[model samples]
Target: MRRLAVLLLTAFTAALTLTSTAGAHWHPKPTTAAWQWQLQGKIDLAIEADVYEVDGFEVPAKTVSALHRKGRRAICYLDVGSWESYRPDADRFPESVLGRAYAGYPDERWLDIRRIDILAPILRSRFDRCRRKGFDAIEPDNIAGYENKTGFPLTAPDQLRFNRWVAREVHRRGMAVALKNDPEQVGQLVGRFDFAIVEECFAYEECGKFSPFVGAGKAVFVAEYSEPLAAICDQAERLRFSVIHKDYDLFARPWEPCFP
Candidate 1:
C-alpha cells in the first residue's frame, strides 16, 4: 500500500507539471499589445514595442533572446502555405506538392495544403527550429491560399484543416501561433489561433471579418502597405487593432503604428 501510494503521487505530480507547462504559452491580449513587423534589413531592436515579429530563419536565436531581455515577445515568421525558392529547406519540398507561382512573387509557389503528409514533416522541422530558437510565437504566413489562384482545387475545408494543424503543431511546441490573413476562416479559427496577423484588411474593407478575434480578446495586428493612417486609424482604434503603415518590403524603417 505504501509503494502504490508513492507511485500515484508521482503520477499526479507529473500531470500537474505537464498542465502548468502547457498553460504557460503566451497569449497576447489586445488591450496591452503593441507590435513591430520587420522581415527585411537588419532587425531594429530599438523599436519600442511589446512584440517584434521577425523572420525565423534570418533572425538568429540571439535576437530572440535580446527581445526577451527587453521584456518583449518575439514572433517568428515563416511561410507555411507557400514554398520559397530561397529557403534553405527548399529542396526538401517534393515537386508533387508544388503548385502555381504565388502571384506577384515569382520565386514563391503555392503549396498544396492537401498534401499534409508530405508537408507535416517539413513544417514540423521548421517549427522545431523556431521553438529551439526561443521564439515566443509563430506567424505562419500565406495561410489563405485556398482563396487564391493556387493550381490546386483546394476548398475552404482543406485550408481549415491545414490551418488547424499549424496551430496544433505550434501549440505542441509550447508557443503561440497567428492566423495570418484568412478572414473567411476567422470565425472557425479564432479559437484555435492565439492571435491574428493580417495585411491590407483596411484597403480591402475586410477588416470587419477579423472582429471575432478582437471580440474574443485576442490581439489583431494589421499591416497596411498603402493606406494612410488618417484613412484607417479611426476605425482601427474602434476595432482595438494594432495597425501599422509599413513599406511593401517590410523593412525596419517607414514604421508607423496607429497606437504609437
Candidate 2:
C-alpha cells in the first residue's frame, strides 16, 4: 500500500507541473496579421484573412475545418460578460444574476461577473464547444463590464480578477484568449492574455492605450466602423496594429484590410 501511495503522489506532482507549464508554451503572436471579424450571417471564408473570428455557437464545425484546411486560424467569439437572451444557454443564467440590458443591445443583459463560481462552468462549456469546433483561440467579448452601467457595482479589481480567471480558464482548455475592449486593464492583463481585440479605439483616440500589448509582442487587432481604410492604414501600420475597416453589420463583402 505504501509503494502504491508513493506512485500516486509522484503522478499527482507531475500532473500539477504540467498544468503550471501548460500555457507557457510560446505562441508567436502574428505580426500585423490579416484578420476578419464576422459575427452575423453565413461566414464567407473567401475573404483574404489569416485569422477568422466568428460566433462560437452559430458557426458550423465544417466551416472551421475548412478554414483549417485553407491554412487559416479561427477565434471563437463568445460573450463572457453579458448574457444574450438569444443564446441557446440563455436559460442557464438565473434572473437574479442578470443585470440591466446591455447598452444598444436590448436583447442582451450584463452578467454579474463577481459570480464567477456560477459563470465559470457555463463558460467552460462554451470553450469546449469552441474546442470541438476546432477554434485556435477565443475572443471573449464584453469583459470590461466594470466600465459600463452593468447594474452591479462592479469595481476595477473585480473586473481584473474575473478577466484573469477567464484567461486562465481558456488556457486550461488549451486555447489562447484575447482581452476584448478592456483597455483600462491592459497593463494588468497584457501578460495574461494572448492578444486583444479593440473596437473603435482609434476613433476614441484610445489606440495608444494598448501599447502594453504591442510592447509585449502580442497582437492588437483593431476594428473601425466608420473610418475609411486610408485614414487609419498609415497609422495602424506605424503602430504595428492589424486593422480593418468594416461596416457595423460585419458582412462578408468589404472586409478592407489596413495592415501595414
| TM-score per candidate | 0.92, 0.93
- Which pairs clash in the backbone of model 2? none
Residue 258, model 1, lDDT: 85
Clash number for candidate 2: 0
lDDT of 2: 0.87
Scored against the true structure, residue 133 in model 1 reaches a CA lDDT of: 98
User: lDDT by residue for model 1 over 106-162, one digit each (tens)?
Assistant: 999999999999999999999999999999999999999989999999999999999
* Per-residue lDDT over 1-260 for candidate 2, one digit per residue giving the tens place of the 0 to 100 score: 99999999999998887687555533536467678999988889888888889999999999999998999888999999999999999999888789999989999999999999899889889988998887888899999899999999999999999999988888877788898988889888898998889998888889899978888888888889977777888888878888988888887766888752
> Which residue ranges in model 1 land beyond 4 Å of their true spot?
1-19
Computed on alpha carbons, the lDDT of every model, listed in order, comes to 0.92, 0.87
